[model samples]
Target chain A: MDQQKLFVQIALHSWNTQIARAEKVFNSYSESEFYKQIAPGKNRIIYLYGHLAVYHDLLKETLGLDTGKYSVLSPLFLQNPDNQESEMPPVKELKAIWNEVHCDLKELFNNVAPEDWFKRHNAMTDADFEKDPSRNRLSVVLNRANHVAYHLGQVVLVKPENI
Target chain B: MDQQKLFVQIALHSWNTQIARAEKVFNSYSESEFYKQIAPGKNRIIYLYGHLAVYHDLLKETLGLDTGKYSVLSPLFLQNPDNQESEMPPVKELKAIWNEVHCDLKELFNNVAPEDWFKRHNAMTDADFEKDPSRNRLSVVLNRANHVAYHLGQVVLVKPENI
Candidate 1:
């Protein structure tokens, strides 16, 4: 296995591990617990899920894949910092969006050609690529994986029903 | 640049960003805030720091770097789940250990040769290397960065002053 192939495997594995960890936390939530904050004035389950759903919207374009199924979420959940008060869709609606968005992403992942993984992202210019040749699909995947793991740790800390 | 050099730069940059982001959260703490939880039944600030400190102790060996310190923290903070009450050092003692550990690590990072970045980590063999070429000093650094980012999100949510 060459380094590029191995790097893609590691990055994808990391992304899968990170997403599974976060899903476990979200799966454990009960109805009431979904809206409860990790700490006072901190983000709740609904907000975090919606935020991630919105942010993953960028991953499509960033990875040279396709997107655009969740723009309605952009206004309500995207711009505000976590825990900021805002009008929100019902939990069921956000869950639907989250599922739809991730399904599209996974489908895109399956269709990407092997050589596409090494291609520069859409925004990379010739000069920028020269300076940081690591700016490719592998870097994008690794970065998003790290981003997911960071937020996963917090999502797990929501106030427990018994606490 | 060749893929090897690009990989090293990406790994080091990721590690540095993760460390800095975590440090920014810790540096914002006051004396009392360091002991507070993200929320009820979640990790306290000091405990998370102690936990990361203990875990990073393994990085020296994992990356083929040297280590001579920080075993004292292993029992108190390592292996234990967060929020479990236990004996603890004073904040100053843990902070001292954290500083010493990182100083040693930074020195180790500086001393690692360019070729060393692609070298297999301790215990990795010919067969394993062929199967997972990404398993090297660079992967260790990148994995540790993701780990730190996970904990940093929790460390940042320590109960706010006003809310």
Candidate 2:
């Protein structure tokens, strides 16, 4: 594999590893514990779960990948940290949403052509490039991985014993 | 402020927002739930905390910034998900470490001369530069914000229902 291919491979593997790791940590919490917040300003476990699920869907849309029935930017799925009861799905339902989103992402990855990986897609603004001047797909992938790993740390920090 | 300063300001604000968000979610879990692995093969709360603390320290060192007594790439701080018991730190200690590291990062950001933010550091490896020419201080900082936001999602997901 060439450099771009190698980077994509690393991204795929890293995402898989993070997902696996997150799944293990997530499963250990009870339903109630998953929704608990230790302090007034803190977020509940449900918020984190919802955030991940929503983000994956958004990323797929940003990359122009198919996200099935999910609208990546749906307001219904977005959480306001202050509004605990607003637009929150039940734990089981949210997990299902997460799984579905992940599945779509996997399919998108599998179908992405190696050449296509270098195609520049403007993520922040959602613009499509006529010819991607910034051939930096690998950087984007790495960015995403770094993004996931960073948040994973927060999830680990707040567990009861650690507090 | 010039465009460069504007960019840095935005980046800094984004990072601060994300760190605060993560802290909020983390404060919500019970001791057992915080350490518990909810999904198979996922990281426990402590493991995630340790990784972020260590990685942030590494980024600081990579940029030739002062990290006080913290050493980058410390093997002792590296947590292997497979060995949860060996890697977990007490919640208080982990939070302290995170706070200290974040403070160091904040200081680094505060002290950044505009020119330095745009300066191109030597690539960590040949592959990093080969992947993209924009892998400079600005890009690195931007990428770091994305990194933090991604992991913050995970923290929110795994939080316990009762503190």
Candidate 3:
């Protein structure tokens, strides 16, 4: 395979690996420990979980992907500090939400026509078509994935030894 | 503080957070998990640990920063299968290397003369810098940070369950 194809494959594999890794981590966590911060003033696993789902929702909108009938939460769910104090769904319920979002994203990726992967959409960035479009999609997808990975690190760090 | 100063502070904070997060995850891992791939045919935690250090080494060279005395590895460490087996370091050694490189990066950030931050280096891309030095620096710094975050995410994703 050529360099571009190699990169795309690597990216897809990276995404798949992360999705499974996250499921494993979240599934293993107890409710109390999942919400605990790894360090003082650091983000907890719940925040990262919410943030990942919210980012996928934004990406769907940005890419104009049809996530039919799925009730993806708004980015505001992760914003607005006052709303953060509100009770979160039980661990199982949150996992279901995460799974649903991932399912939609997987579907979207499956349907992305290779020729259209580089197609520019005005909703995401102001850059013109003359600029490379693949770079844009790559940036968004990679950025979101990285965001999840960063938080997963946080979760692993803070998790109690006994639990 | 002006916008430039604000950006510098943000960049510094991001670098600090990433290193701390990496250290947290690094310390939690067992020896076996460090080299174990969380998923079949996927990256090991040790791969990420080494990759991050190597990437910093590359970026330092790119920006004309000191890379110390070690011979820098080629960028294609991922592609060459032969190199992969022979060059892979033990988890403990990789973590120590990451910590050392992380410190070097922190020191580099601390000593960056504000004027040097604004200085334009010839980028591989066609983006024009003569129009605004501040904008150029912002783009460069943001892009570099994203690069680091991307690899750091890989580290988190590959963490073993027991670790």
Q: Which one wins on lDDT? A: 1
TM-score of 3: 0.50
* lDDT, residue A133, candidate 1: 74
Among all candidates shown, the one with the greatest TM-score: 1
List TM-score per model, in order.
0.85, 0.51, 0.50
After superposition, candidate 1 runs with Cα above 4 Å error = A82-87, A113-115, A122-126, A159-163, B82-87, B113-135, B159-163
Ranking by DockQ: 1, 2, 3
CAPRI classification of candidate 2:
incorrect
TM-score of chain A of 2: 0.79
- Per-residue C-alpha lDDT of model 3 across residues A1-163, encoded as one tens digit per residue: 3323333443454456656777788777788876775444445677667666666656776666764332344433455421436676666777777788788888888787644544555355556644533334544454455566655655555544311
lDDT of 1 by residue, B68-87 (tens): 46766677677666655686
> lDDT per residue, candidate 1, A118-143, as tens digits?
67887688789777777777677777
Query: Candidate 3, residues B1-163: lDDT per residue as tens digits?
Result: 3434433553444445556676787677778777665334455666666666676655565555675433444443333322336556566666676677777767876788755665555454335544533333324444455455555554555542312
Predict model 1's lDDT versus the native.
0.74
Q: Please provide, for model 2 over B1-163, each residue's C-alpha lDDT reduced to its tens digit, 9 standing for 90 to 100.
A: 2434544553455457667766776776766666765334555666666666777777775666663455532454553342565645578877788898888888787998865765555446657655653455655555555566655555555544321
Name the lDDT value of residue A135 in candidate 2: 27
